[model samples]
Target: MKVASFLEDVKFNSNKPSVLMLMDTDFSKELRVVFKKGQIMEDHQAPFAIVVQVIKGAIDFGANEELIQLNDGDLVSLKPHIVHNLSAAEDSVVRLTLSKADSLQRVKNV
Candidate 1:
């Protein structure tokens, strides 16, 4: 069994969001994405589906040409090839779930 905490040793960056791989499960890769206010992960598309959950603070989730406000405890999912992006409404910590087939480098490149 693997154990991890998204909130543990949390850190943020001024120039970009901090991304960390929390664990690699049987079917998915769990990640912790920390964003300071106004930071953004610009529009990008995932080759596989993904799930994103707001663990703390607020975010503006841009997808489907819509800006969705996600507060604490909010979650969103996107299908493969869907273009999306994230903007922090405040200092935020997000939990991201990616398909096992997704590359960690692809996320880091964004």
Candidate 2:
């Protein structure tokens, strides 16, 4: 049983946003992000699958070129190898859960 929390160190991201990694490991990675207006998460595709939950504020997710607005309480899963990007509409916070390669590969085979 291991527990982790946000780091005190401040890191700036796109649009002057900030971020924190609550947990990052070979098995699974968890991240907590704080987004400023106009902040964008550049386009990226992960080899492993991922789960994203909107913890606060609002965001728009572009998945496979399809756009959808996500508000608080929204949860979505990004399939392995899918092109995805994120942008914040307002000051927001989000949690990302990324699965390891081993687990993602099994799902791909099914």
Candidate 3:
């Protein structure tokens, strides 16, 4: 197993999102994305499943046209092909855990 350390502060540029690949293998990719205040990931869906965890600050989630607010320590999963989106509020850092479609669906249902 690989051991990783916790992240401290991160910075993002204007009109661009900051992305960090915390872990990546042939089967999956784990990322830590930082969105500045008022940053939005835009409205879209992914081909695979993704899990979002609010590490710090706050985030607004939009899925199926429904809005959900997430704070520190909160976690959420996105189903494949589901319409979903994310936005940051006042300097937020979100951890995105992405995995294979089949594996994610099985995990989600279990």
| Number of the predicted model whose TM-score against the real structure is largest | 1
What do the candidate models score in CA lDDT, each in turn? Answer: 0.95, 0.72, 0.73
Reference-based lDDT, residue 25, model 2: 81
Q: What are the models' TM-scores?
A: 0.97, 0.73, 0.81
Write the number of the candidate with greater lDDT, choosing between 2 and 3: 3
lDDT of 2 by residue, 24-94 (tens): 58788677777777888777777777898887779998997699999997989977888888888886787
Ten-residue region with minimum lDDT total, candidate 3:
101-110
Candidate number that wins on lDDT, 1 or 2:
1
Can you tell me which runs of candidate 3 are displaced by over 4 Å? Answer: 25-27, 100-110
Clashes of each: 0, 0, 0
Best by lDDT: 1
lDDT of 1 by residue, 35-95 (tens): 9999999999999999999999999999999999999999999999999999999999999
Ranking by lDDT: 1, 3, 2
lDDT of 1: 0.95
